[model samples]
Target: MGKLASECETERARTLTKEGISMDSEKVIKRDNEYVLHTYNRNPIALEKGHGLYAEGPEGQKYLDFTSGIGVNSLGYCDLTWAEAVSEQAHKLQHTSNLYYTAPCGKLAKKLCKRTGMNKVFFGNSGAEANEGAIKAARKYSFDHYGKGRDVVITLVNSFHGRTIATLTATGQEVFHNYFGPFNEGFVYTTAGDIEGLRELVDRHTCAIMLELIQGEGGVMALDPEYVQAVRALCDEKDLVLIVDEVQTGVGRTGTFLCCEHYNLKPDIVTLAKGLGGGLPIGAVLLNEKTAEGMGPGSHGSTFGGNPVVCAGANVVVDRMDQSFLANVSERAVQLRAGLAKLPMVKNLSGIGLMVGIEFFGGIQAADVLAACREKGLLVLTAKSRLRLLPPLTLTAHDVEKALGILNEVLTEMEQKAPKEQA
Candidate 1:
């Protein structure tokens, strides 16, 4: 959901012919503009390769990747274990549709269920699909038991679910309600931490309540633990399913496998993606026993849901987030937060583990600051009006310090320039 510092609008008058020419970064951008959909406003840098916590552009310019491809490159590009696993799986069995059984998918699902203490998992290709499947299960569960007119779901405002029509409808941000009119119905919204507002939205018709423990795209705001507890209690009292969308906050991104773990929660369903498959596309809907039986066979399915290669990559990614690695993430988060809070430009900070959001109080726009960061060989992201950082969990201490130095310098310059511009 971040914008590029500069638009990729450079016009080049070259076209590919029968004799294939190796494309450089600029050429790649031109080719994309020629072929790919214009849905995304992309960064101008066309990356050639990456390793550790850095990526190289077409001209071999190294960039310390703080965005981590919006937190997808969990192991930080070309990670040996993840790459090997994915490669081996591709060679052995690239894909097997839902009609057939695949070892990698089964193994990955079992590992997730065991680690999270969830009853079962439904694999999909992205976070939106995971959430879509979760919504279906919740609706089905209610239909099976409570009967009709109880299918409405309540979501918190400033929360983001996904781009799919159903998930988008479930998303509470009004800005995303653009050209896509007549969105799916049966969804309502409430403000974060407003127990009274949540109660007002709830009635006999509400079947489930979906929430992202931390609203990642909504400026990385974390809801109060007490408020989460209250929601859980309300769900229990009404026999309504609780769904946690951990698409961005799961898989150790929050210093724990699921952010709900930090709140001592066991929601009826939890969705995951983003960092799950290292750099590959994968997603999962983890269900507790209560709602596990609701989704029977033939109710929901995907063709490329649990491709063996993607699951193989996810296996290694999950293994890398074990106890010690998670502890290290927590330590690094503390170090990063302390350093960021001391910067003169940082107005406020929010987030957990390596997922961070920064706001500036010195009249500096998030886009301008990010453009400066990108110019200095740093890649970052913006959520709403805050500059968001999802640096790789594997980032070295030295790299963290170096990134902080760049940020400090940029903030100092902004702070000084703000007054001069005012004068």
Candidate 2:
């Protein structure tokens, strides 16, 4: 036999090592800390590469990734099709200013509008930019139709919009408001699901109501469907633009093209990022008929917006969001939710589809759980105090079983260490 399979694999790895394809984890981490900004409290491990649902450390340690690069790797790591599309477009053309049109960009926009039933699409580089565009569009539409002074937009308290000055100001968390002084005006915050309170907040100054259908960073909390319907009705009654920020919940992240599908409502504007471009940087604002004319030339733009390479990658991702793919996503979500619910430490679960949040009882610290999971070859994330899991939608049943087993072991060990009364 031509060398055993394991031997061949070992030989390939050895060759790669000799060629210096991987480096010392400590050295890489040290270099990164020296050069990179200190904004993120990064994990100790230095990831080298990844394939499918797992990423490998520099030292050959493998990790089952539940975070999916914070929900950007919708197709998991290094998907061949996505990579090929990006590479092909890179060889052909990469970046072009919005002054000219490209086939990839136009095709991707058409696909997005077709899938989401939106009238127009504006591409950008990230969720924040998309939201910024949506905000501008809403304000402009209000100014054109209802005249000035109606520029205020109401966002939900506890919502996390983005990191830019405008988006940060729009974020409802008071904790994020520190040191950002005299933040952008015209943004108001209200409790999520309190339609009456939301109504009370709206006035002649209110132009739009923006929210995340599933608050991914705010503890993976899915807004109540009835409340969402009420909000839509209120928007219609008040003639205010409805903006849905699906940055984390869009592009099959929640087992649907958009989470708004689950709620049976289409808002006037939708902001998308994260999973939209698979692993690439891409953001989009989807406009409905009512707000299709909200933006005009010189109103808003991005230099790298609709970059051909990014659009090529996004085309593959969005094209795959068909009925069959989305159905599988839904099935996987059910499997994951059922498995997570069986854990003894899980107090409750929130979220729909692959977007999950596990609230633990017995005073279990989510940070401790995250660290333990990391040590045990699993990568997870935290939203507020809850353990958030946003695994790749393509994760198989076997992957779900394995992940749950690892999580169960971790939680069981933690439970055993808890005080008897608390346990």
The lDDT of each candidate is: 0.89, 0.91
> Which candidate ranks first by TM-score, i.e. highest?
2
lDDT of 1 at 211: 96
lDDT value for model 1: 0.89
| lDDT of prediction 2 | 0.91
lDDT of 1 by residue, 15-99 (tens): 3333466668888899999999999989887998788998998678999989988989977878877877777777688876999
Residue 181 of model 1 has an lDDT of 82
* TM-scores for candidates 1 onward, in order: 0.94, 0.95
Clashes of 2: 0
Model 1 residue runs over 4 Å out of place are 1-20, 420-423
What would the TM-score be for candidate 2 when compared with the true structure?
Answer: 0.95
